[model samples]
Target: MNSTLQPTALTEHVPQPVTRTERVQTIDLIRGFALLGILMMNIPGFGFPYTRFPLIYGTPGSTDFYTAMGIDTAFSGTMRALFSMLFGAGMLLFMAKKEDLASGHSVVDFYYRRLLWLVLFGVINAYVLLWPGDILYAYGLCGLLLYPFRKLRPAYLLIGMMLCMILPVLRNIQNTVETKQKRTTYWEAVKAEEQKKKLTDEQKKAKEEWENQLKWTKFDTKKDAEIVRKMQLGYGQVFAKLMPRNSNIESRGMYYGFWDMLGMMFLGMALLKLGFFTNKLPTSTYWLTLGLGYSIGLLLGNIQFYDQVAYILDPGAYVDTHFFSVFDLYDLRRGATAIGHASLLLLVYRSGVVPWLMKALANVGQMAFTNYLMQSIICTLIFYGYGFGYYGKLAFHQLYYVVAGVWVFQILFSAVWLRYFRFGPFEWLWRSLTYWKRQPMRLQSEPVPAAPQTALF
Candidate 1:
């Protein structure tokens, strides 16, 4: 008795990967939907040197213009918002069980280990793969700060989320004020120069600032051409060109965007804790959420879209007329839209009318990590010089053809791959690394375990 141990004693406290039966199907479905939707916004960045000018890419009211407008209105930041929220929910899911603590294995250790690996994967995605818009690095870094708040009440998490959002809103206000000041100074300086008057230092600085900003926002054919040429260079040359941009995004951009991601994550945690992501809420509640979320989100989103169209038509006038009011509510619009999207999808899932489509999407979501990296690899190869070298050649609307192809491939591939395997390739690798052991990969011939009808949360 003193020397022996029961089977439960040895196995019950060991940490393990989430089984398929334990997964929340609604979460997977939403994730899969978000993964595909992200490509709608990302395709432009993949195929074009700059994505600001639908007017230049195509005439006003053309297919390109409408495409850009539609994407801006419907997707833009919404897919990423969904992903961020899901990531937060996942953190709680990972730490939900406390049995590991009894076996001297801290869940915190596993969580950090998972995040560090994600950080490395993000580096590989951004630097090695040359995808400057990669979100993994930002997510990994932000996730490091999530563990401390895991046990907070849902209400407290919501409060934290709102608090975090305040920073980005304030930043928008600051940027708007600074931009207006720069424009005023530059115009005054222009008038003074015309009168043969000496320019003040502040005016000179403002002129330079405004011009630099124009270099990015205002279309210049020559600059665009140079970007195309660089993207069409050899791997080493392209990497050299992309390095600084990726560095800036990883450093400065990540810093500024940290609170945004963190806030969404907090919201995700709150939602999961409240049973929103698990589809445990009442049907009427979901209906009400869909109604209110879309009503508010679309209203604000359309206003922002109108401003975007106005900017495309006349940047100068758009700047003069548009303050940061709509921009300040950017988070709210996307956040609401994301929630609406989730509600609609959940309603559909609950209805069971599109079982095949839902099942396929859930499979895709299950393999989301692999599919995400695959998108980067496939898109870079298609657009970069070392492969197809089609960068900057496709119009705004044409890129969706590529997106549609990727979606078809990923959906089919995920369904087939999971038939024989328990996890996506990357997911298995990540779990293996986190556990410091090779987790099971291949599905055995045993009877499939039925999924829980309700989520643990």
Candidate 2:
């Protein structure tokens, strides 16, 4: 039907509020779910550094170790995978609207303009805000490359998704090799220094160089303490201390994230075209998806759980240069679990299992852009020296309490805000910029939908 519609003919519908009655609420609900769920994984990084790792391995049955393991095994990459696919689905939705408006206006303009702004936002987040693990930069890059693949058949899209995953796997392998080489070189230098009866100038220089190189490879409590102090000193001091180590911009920002994120985006597009996101699939199909996805994914995930635990805990593992072993199958495990999650969420949504909860989640999803930025701002202030200065203070498990608190606040705030306003504050700004027109914000003039008589609890 959209193919026959003139672009100008659909002008009135081009930028309608996503909350309108005609919208598919399930997508927004999942997005809202993702918006909150992601904090479960990200709180640690916000409180410390993303690269900050444990010096000693976890005790098998200990509280801290098992907590860390559970979080990583269940959530870490899964949330990111789900979030990336959702973004891809959103893009496809936007394109579908454009097709219906095929009035010859430059869809390219819309696509590029939105992603270009997103790229700028990513830069600010990474450098100015000093959140080194920011994914927006990576998303912008993936999105720039995704527009051309929009019309591919599902089979072709799946093929493309498989191809996109290769580079991240390769990138991880490359990192593992480089880490091994660095460790070997550093240890050899130490051995040589130990053997020397008198320290020669050349040998001393070599030892110092190797020591510096090894500093980043090992986890040192003293180094972590100093870094924490710097974070407490001021924002500028923290920025100076951390920026040099922000190498994710090189690795993840380049090939690794490009592959990992774009692959999921491709999968999302394929799924959307197949009507997966629109509740077109049967409940039985979703149940089977849930069963198979969780079985395969959780199996792969748990297989490495102990190995990863052992890798971090065993000093011998690091000394033996086997630190990279844990990540060997990271990509595949995450991909499987991500599908599992998507299936579970879709099944619940299609079943109308919890209308009130679903409505709240949809509100959150509609305002995800606003809430994401909000989280960054709030957490930085809460943890940095500039605000309450709680950086690097909490234990791994306790940090989640902060996450829970934030979620409660966001959900309650979002629900209340959406009742009166058509868009979240940041969403309105982004939409205005993307359209180059000031969109409506207040809902006072619009007819209000009748409120439910009963309380939601």
Candidate 3:
């Protein structure tokens, strides 16, 4: 009866230990989610003729309201932010490992070499490859800039990131104002041209055909197949050199998506330094962050998404007058929303929700460097002429199937391939170049073996 619990009985125990490999699993999961999200966003452009911007900026609300609003904001913008953050996190990891080596030589040399190679890879992807919607070039270029800044204090890096984020917002506003003014002038000219080209019955019919051709260049595959051929073949000789109505300013990937990527990267770097990735935060804190972010981001995100849909349906006074200006507030709102989304994702990974799902995501993530490019490669084959030539044919909703198909393939391929290989093909090449030595490509050790199942992140 005097037997009070012994001190040993009261103590808690730390059970199993995690290896370096398991620690990397978290990173792989993050990358997997990011890569998948990216595919979701890019699928539209891959299947559609894509006459305009694939993102909401080009053609708002063309897709279903729910799809446009729910998917675009939640997945498109936010996922991209997550991916960029992962990239930044990876940079820190790579640098840290190098530093841990304590090699007599500086790691900066190898760092620059990797970035330079990445830039080259981006260039190849942009021009020589299929899809022009390349982010590697921007990442490579900005990452090069980040080289010096990486060594700066975390606080300074955060400040620099804020400035970069603001720059894009300001530029967007400026462009919006200027675009409205120019569009008015352009519309008037187009109307006047239509009037001047008034023609006789036969000429009028021919003119209508010409106008249609000008709009899509691939219109009327039945009777006007010849015309379509001419348009396609002559595209190089005729319009290839024709100056874009707008200057080269927007065409450059730098101005379009570079800042977005940079913002995410900086945030990632800051979070990584803050120990966000190290599972240091309380579970309650993570849940609270996710709840707040999802609520605010989803609410605002839905509003903007619906706004785009409404604008597209009627496209009346508001469409003509306001256009890119209406939801200026939402653009900034997206940043807040992205924070929430990123926070939630991090929490999931830390919490070890679904171990199997996390493992799958991590597998895909481990091969992310390969999978990212593989996406572009596979998408180009699915959409472009050199492959199936299905581009511009599939409807918005129909594109989802292609995306789903690709997702299944990627997951299956990643899991199976990883069973036999150490790193993804491209990942291995990257490591080899980074280390200046060939890396082992096969599994040198047995699987760690799965543990008791739990909820996945």
Clashes of each: 0, 3, 8
- lDDT per residue (tens digit) for residues 29-137 in model 1: 8999998898888887788867347354335668887777678777779999999999998888776655355647787788899899999999999999889999998
lDDT of 2 by residue, 104-220 (tens): 456567767888878777777778777666777778777888888888999998898888776666767787666566556556666776787565565566566656644554677
- Model 2: residue 168 alpha-carbon error in angstroms: 2.7
Candidate 3 structure quality by residue, lDDT tens digits, 158-217: 786787777876777886665555445455555756899544554544445434434542
* Global Cα RMSD, each model: 5.1, 5.6, 9.7
lDDT scores for all predictions?
0.83, 0.70, 0.60
Off by over 4 Å in 1: 1-13, 51-58, 99-103, 445-457
Which candidate should be chosen as best, given lDDT against the real structure?
Answer: 1
| lDDT, candidate 1, at 407 | 96
Ranking by lDDT: 1, 2, 3
After aligning candidate 1 to the native by TM-score, how far in Å is the CA of 194 from where it should be? 1.4
**lDDT for position 416 in model 1:** 93
* Best by the TM-score measure: 1
